[model samples]
Target: MAGFRYEEVAGSIAGQVEAGVYGPGDRLPGVRKLARQFGVSVSTVVAAQHLLEDRGVIEARPRSGYYVRLRPQRPPQAPERTRPEGQPTQVTGQALVLRVVQAANEPDTVQLGAAVPHAEFLPTHGLQRAFSGVPRRYPGRATDYLFPPGPVELRQQIARRMADAGCRLSPEEIVVTNGAQEALVLSLRAVAEPGDVVAIESPTFYGLLQAIEGQGMRALEIPTDPDEGISPEALALALEQWPVAAAMLMPNFGNPLGHRASEGRKREVVALLEERGVPLIEDDVYGDLAFEAPRPWAAKAYEDRGGVLYCGSFSKTLSPGLRVGWAAPGRFRDRLEYLKYAASAATPAFPGFAAADFLARGGYDRYLRRVRGEYARAVARVRRAVARYFPEGTRQTDPEGGFVLWVELPAEVDSLALYQAALAEGISIAPGPMFSPTQRFRNFLRLNCAQPWNGNFERALRRIGELARERSG
Candidate 1:
């Protein structure tokens, strides 16, 4: 515990900087004096300052004290909250989605399009170690069909983790699946029938739109705030007007927009839907990736009557290749379990066992802490570059967590054209239209900030900015 005093010192100084105690280019007091002030050793102050430097909060000068790092110029205006007319529509734009995915796969391209974290940021060796032990630990169980409920070890791990999201579920309540996508699929099927309407956040993750389309359901786009999440007032109006069977929401660091709804907002939306006899399929795949400590709660956390079907996956935080995911459907537990059996049966056994192994051994919590900090720095780096390089009038989301940054380009610029131009330069960007069922958000785009920050990455972003400027011209 004495070793952690430096972290406390660093946090206190960072808080001071955040509170404007030190301005850009402002010098920090010499190491010894600060140590005296904080009641820590000079060595502790040095350690804390080293951490601040790594966090990009301060810079060390030759024979001079550290100064707060000068930040890039920010856009003067805030991004407008989306106000999609609450109308149910059939989803399209899967073609564009495919093209973006393909571009992301190109070996020579800068991967700033897909939301996948950079392979370097993932715990590749740790996961490999976890995977290698599956056979020895689980015996012949690793080779057999895991069945619907999956291996108890994995289900128990998931149930334990779900408690952080405010759900006290048994392993029996969890149904393992291929990924969050499959979990979403099963949740959607369990709650709604074909031809039903599913309310969703406007400018939502494209995958959600595709899932709604695949289910033969219509998506009613509700006005969503990039900071707060789907508007409850708009949702209430939509529910009153439409014959909605279910509502799919991502209250915890949602995709593309990267917004985390507040706990009060989550409770409000949950109660609103539960009272209307509507089911909420809560996609919380990115919940654990919050930049700050003490991860946020899920909308499912606020509901008790089985109205909220919670879906999550390790694909985003852990290993996507493992394809480990699960759903806690509460009252719809039986329905979702049967649907999982009918749709994909049991998922691959080794992945579940390996994932459970890693989680049980206490490797995941450590990785979560490291990965969250990595992503926070990466997101801030990309945000600074976008603000400094992009044309005036461009606004982007300041995400609370997750690796995605959604940019709202100038109205004169078409993000589709920008995407094509960036692709030609061996860079990939997610055009705005794909995030919508009706192909809206033509002037918007989302960028992946999980890539390691380097000259190549910065060059790619600058070139994308050039492309946007050309389009606007």
Candidate 2:
């Protein structure tokens, strides 16, 4: 440690790169300067530079000094790929999801936040196998774009799969989009116009809020429950008091709250909406991820008139990177399809074909079964951890499926402050205010239970609890 040589200096520099102290393309100190810093010969510094370059960690330019390559600085194993450059689109609701992921993935962050699945549990190799088989079957079509409604095979599969949930649909009923996010957006554009009053769950997916905001529409929050999703009585009350053009909801595994509105209640609500002549946009992105018995069908299943626009995606089940999702607009299918064309002209081709092949290979059901089992176990662990570490009287909503857990902390605890403090401790969580219309759930926080039981996650949860107790006291 007293008089370090070349290997030590090189090791130290590599550690800095791994720690993100030097970013991609950042130049390293000159070899002579490094030699002096390490009190080593220039030859040793040169050898270290050569070693780093050989390892594909860095590269040297002809005239310039050595620079950190983008490849080497990245973790040898990242949880999942992330696109960091996308600007905060004026597009609604995107920021809410992004904010949660951003907080979780930050360096050294304790990720008690964000609904991301554990990296180790993901079926990456299965997806790769699915990808490989795509080109072998259709060498020419694999690279070609499937404009608008996406691949026919994938759409057909979706239509067929809808039967499991008690919904009857022809392939024409389905329109593929990038993800459920797009499905929600397309439904919003198709049914509601600018300045229309769009009723939403009081504490809804913030992304949906952003979508409504982007369309220049007004949002009316109906009081909702943590266990049963939107309160039917509350929605009926809002409909009576206000002239709502359209309503959006997550009837199954509602984000933030993880509530699954009962079938009886869903039917009642659907009937009421029909009587009021208002359309409903049902976001069911997590419907298939249910860990309990066969999940409930869409509220649209009961409607004869197709007043419900049902949107879902394989992003949670298969692969998020594929960005494959679909919509069944009970009455507005044509409008939703056309809107899909106008938005992106077309969904990417390979991903659609690959997804279709993946499902057709008889792997889809197997994957879901495995995912549900793993997630259920992880959820149990998460529940036990919360019950043990969180304060007494702190309530939690138990989701039948999906990876999100919403915790209600003491009223005195400001989740915004807790979020900020948790970030400093290298942990990330979604603040309660982001999910509400009037930010009414300021004392709440949403944690991602998708992460497995690990020391890093456990410590982060404890830290978050400590902070909450301090603030509450």
Model 2 — TM-score against the truth? Answer: 0.78
Can you write out model 1's per-residue Cα lDDT over 141-238, one digit (the tens) per residue?
88999889888999999989988888888999888999999999889999898999999998899888888999899999999998899999999999
Q: Write candidate 2's Cα lDDT for 249-309 as tens digits.
A: 9988888777788899889989999999999999988888776557678787878789999
lDDT for each candidate structure: 0.87, 0.77
Candidate 1 matches the true fold with a TM-score of: 0.87
Please list all clashing residue pairs in model 1, or write none if there are none. Answer: none
Deviation of model 1 at 437, angstroms:
0.8
lDDT for predicted candidate 2 compared with the true structure: 0.77
Candidate 2 residues lying further than 4 Å off, grouped into runs, are: 1-97, 104-107
Query: How many clashing residue pairs appear in each of the predictions shown?
Result: 0, 7
Each model's TM-score?
Answer: 0.87, 0.78
